[model samples]
Target: PFTLRDKGMKHMVGKNWRDLFDLVIVQAGKPNFFTDRRKPFRKLDEKGSLQWDKINQLEKGKIYKEGNLFDFLRLTGWRGSKVLYFGDHLYSDLADLMLRHGWRTGAIVPELETEIRIINTEQYMHSLTWQQALTGLLERMQMYQDAESKQVLLEWMKERQEIRSLTKNLFNPQFGSIFRTFHNPTYFSRRLVRFSDIYMASISCLLNYDVNFTFYPRRTPLQHEAPLWMDQLCTGCMKTPFLEEMVHIR
Candidate 1:
C-alpha cells in the first residue's frame, strides 16, 4: 500500500524546526545515505510539481540543488572564527566540515567508542592481575594448612601485611590527586575500589569533610546500624537511663 511519493514525502517533511530560517531546503540529496546510488536534486513547487531541472547542478537561492555547505557559506558572506558545526555522523558531516572546510566540528556519538574501549581495557588488565594474585595466595594458604606448618603460615601473613602497608603508602597520594582533579567527593568514593591501592586513603578520608561526616562511621566494618525509627522517636526515649547505661558499658 506504500508508494515512493508517500515514503519520500514523509522523509522530506518529517523534520520539525523551531522557526523558518533564511532558507528552507527539502529533498536534500545526502550522499552518505546511499552507498552506490546517486540521486539527482529535484526542485518542486507547493503542489510537489517539478518546477526546475538542474539535476546535479547547483543554483543559488534555490531549494533542493546539488551544492556544498562551503559554497552556501561563501555566498552568504559569513566571515567569523566562531563558527561551530555539530553532527551525529563523524565520517559525513563532521569530517567534511573539519577537513575540507576548516570549520570546527563537534561529533556526537551516542555511545563514545574511544571511552568504551579505554574502560574495557583497564578493567580487563586489572581483573586478570587480581585474579592471578588471589589464586596464588589461596593455593599457598592451602599448602601451608595441609602441611601443618605454623612457620610457613606466619611468614605468609607477615608478607601479606608488609604488602598491604606498602600498597597503602603508594596508593594514598594517587587517590588524593584523583579527588583533587575531579573535585567531586561522591563520585570519587563510589569508584574508589576500581583505582590503585595508593588512592584508597583518598576515598577513606573523604568523610573528613563536614558534608561527609555522617558517611565515615558507616564505612567502618564493625559499626552497628541504628534502629529504623530511632530518629523519629522522642529525644527523651533516645536518651533513656537503660540506653545510657548500655552505651557507657560498650
Candidate 2:
C-alpha cells in the first residue's frame, strides 16, 4: 500500500492516493505473499494501530496488512494485465506475480537516472565512439605480420582495455552498472527484462503518460543481421591512426 504521503505522488496526481486504487495492501510479505495462502488479511487502524481480526472484504481509505495473492485476487477479482504491480525489488516484489500469476509488473530502478546521466556526458560518448573504432581496427590486427605493426596493434589493445576500465568506473568504481558488464547486458538486466513488463527510474514516470498509453519493446537485431551502421563504422575505421600506421608499414 503506497500512501500519497510521498510528496512526488502528491504533486503529480492531485487526489487522494487511496482513491486511485481499488485496494492497498502493506507488509505484503511477497514471494511468500504470492506463494502462501494461510496468512489472512488484517485491518490497520487509521492511527497506525493493527487489528488482528481475519477479515474478508477489502475497503478503500483503510490500510490492510499481511495477506496473500490468492486471497487478494479472489477478493478483488483484479487479475492478469488489469493488475499492474509496481515493486522496487525484482525477485521479491515482482518475479512471482509476473511469472506465476500473470500480473504485469513495473520495476522501479532509481539507479537508471545516474546511469543515463553518465552515458550522456561528453567523456563517456568519446570513449564509446573510440572503442567502436578500435574494434574495427582490431579486426585488421591479424593481417599485419611485421614487428612494428604487431607493436602498434598491442598498444591499441592496451588502450581499448584502459578505455573499458575508465568507462566502467564512470558508472561504479567496483561492480560497475547492474544493467551492463562492458558492452553486454548483465545477469541482473536479463532477469529484469524477463520479470518486469515495464521499467523506469521512478513510478512517477507514469504521470507523463495517458491512462491508455501502450508501450512497445524495441526490436534489436541479432548479430547475423547486420546493423545499419556496420558499413559506415567499418569505413570510418580507415580514418584512424591505426590505418595510417598500416599504410606506413607498407
Candidate 3:
C-alpha cells in the first residue's frame, strides 16, 4: 500500500510507519520482490535500534526488508488468495502483483483528473463547435451534393483535430496520455484492459466509498450477444449486492 515511487514522495501519514504493520519490507525490488527468493526480515532491538540478524516469525510492529510475498503472508497468517495489494503501474504494480503473487490487486491511476475533465468540458466544447456546421452538412449530404459533402467533411475533421489537441495538451502537450490515442485506446491501454482487476483515480478514491464493496462490472450484451437491430441494452445500476465487507472509518 506504500512505496517510494520518487525521492520526495510521502510513504505514509497519520501513523508511525513501523507501528502500522506486523512487518514492513523495503528495497525488495518488485515485481521481482514477489517472484524472487526474498531476503529475511530485520527486526529492531529493544532500545529502538536496527538488528542486522534476519529471522522468521512475526514480532508485531517490527520492520523488515527484502522478503517475498508468500513469507509475509505466512507471518500474517493468510494464504496468497486472501491477500490484496494495490499499486499504480499497470504492468509493474497491478499486473505483475496479480500474475506472479496470486494476490488480488487494485490499480491507482493519478491522471484520471485529466481524462475526466476532457470528457466533461472538452466534449461539450467539441459538440458546440460542430453543431450548426454538421447539421447543415447532413442536409447537404441528404440532397446528394457530393462536392459539398467533401468540403464539409474536411471542415469536420479540422474541428475534431482542434478539440482533440486541446484535451491531449492538458495531459501531455508533447505525447498525450498512455491510456488514450485519439478516439481509440493507446497501446498501453490495450494491455491495461487485459490485466487490471480494478482501477480508480487514486488510492484515496476508495476512501470516499465503501472500502469493502465488491465491484461488479457492467454486464451489457455486445452486438453479437444481443438480437440484431436491438441496438442497445440497459446494463443496470453499478452497485454490488449486500456489501458486508465494506468498512467505515471514523
Candidate 4:
C-alpha cells in the first residue's frame, strides 16, 4: 500500500529528510486516516506484502503501512495533543492535523516570490503614496460636506482610482499578490491564518538561525498586538507587519 510519488522515499534529497525520522510510515492514508475510524497497522515486506502477525508491533528500523494514529501514539508513549506537524498542504496536511489532533502547524509556500519582490522595492513606496493620498481626500470630504466640496471630491476620486489601478498592476498584470485580493485576503491566505502558526518561503531559512533561540513576532499596531509604543513606517501609511518592514515577510 506504499504510494511511490518519486523514486522511493530513501532516494529523496540524499536521505537528509527521512534520515531524521525514528519511525517511517508509508502510505498511511493521511487525511482519511485522521478523519475516519482507525485502521490496522501492518508491517510491509520488501516485495510489498503485509505480515499479518506484525500488526500493531512497531520497530525503529521497520517500515509500516495502513497505521492507526492511536497505535503510533501508544508505541511512542505520546499523546495527540502534544505534537507539532509541519506540512505543505492546507486541507490534506494542515487542516486535518489541526481539526483532529490539535497539532500546531507550519506551511511552506514557494509562490510568495513574485509578490514579495515587488513589495520590497522602492516602487512600493510610490504605491503607498497613492494609497495615503486617497485616504486624505476621503477625510476632507467627510469634514467639508458642502456642494462645492462634493464636486471636488468627485474629481479627486476619479484621479485616485486610476492611480490605485496603476499601483496594483505594477506588481502583476493578472493577480497582485496571492495573499491578498484588494483589501480582503485570498482564500489561500485565510487558511494560513486559521491553521498555520507561521509560514516561511522555505524550511532552509531556519538553518541560519539558532535552534535554541526563541522567535517573538514584533508588535504591529491594530493587529491584535498591544505594545508600549508604535513605530511609524510612514507618516500616513497603514501599520506594516514587522517582518514586512524588514522586507523578509515569510
TM-score of each predicted structure versus truth: 0.31, 0.79, 0.65, 0.72
User: Which candidate leads in lDDT?
Assistant: 2
Off by over 4 Å in 2: 1-15, 44-56, 228-250
Q: For model 1, how does the per-residue alpha-carbon lDDT over 1-250 read when each residue is reduced to its tens digit?
A: 1134435645765533212234444544454322223444456554446665654444443445344454446455543334555455445545544554566544444333433343356443353333334334544444555455666656645654554444333324344222223213445343332221112112224345675233222232222333345323322222333223324222
Q: Comparing candidate 2 with candidate 4, which one achieves the higher lDDT?
A: 2
Best by TM-score: 2
lDDT of model 2 at position 193:
93
State the weakest 10-residue window (summed lDDT) of model 3: 241-250
Comparing 1 with 3 on lDDT, the higher-scoring candidate is 3
Clashing pairs in 1: 170-198, 171-197, 171-198, 171-199, 172-198, 175-199
lDDT rank order = 2, 4, 3, 1
Q: TM-score ranking from best to worst? A: 2, 4, 3, 1
lDDT string for model 3 (181-218, tens) is: 65467987776666676777887777877868877765
Q: What are the lDDT figures for the candidates, one per model? A: 0.41, 0.80, 0.59, 0.67
- RMSD, candidate 1, Å: 18.5
Give the alpha carbon lDDT tens digit for every residue of 1-250 in model 4. 4546224655766544445667778787887766555687788775667778756457776668877676676677654555667777888888877776777777888776666777777767666655655555465445777899788778767876776776678767687667876656788889887888777777776787897756666655564434445453432344433322434311
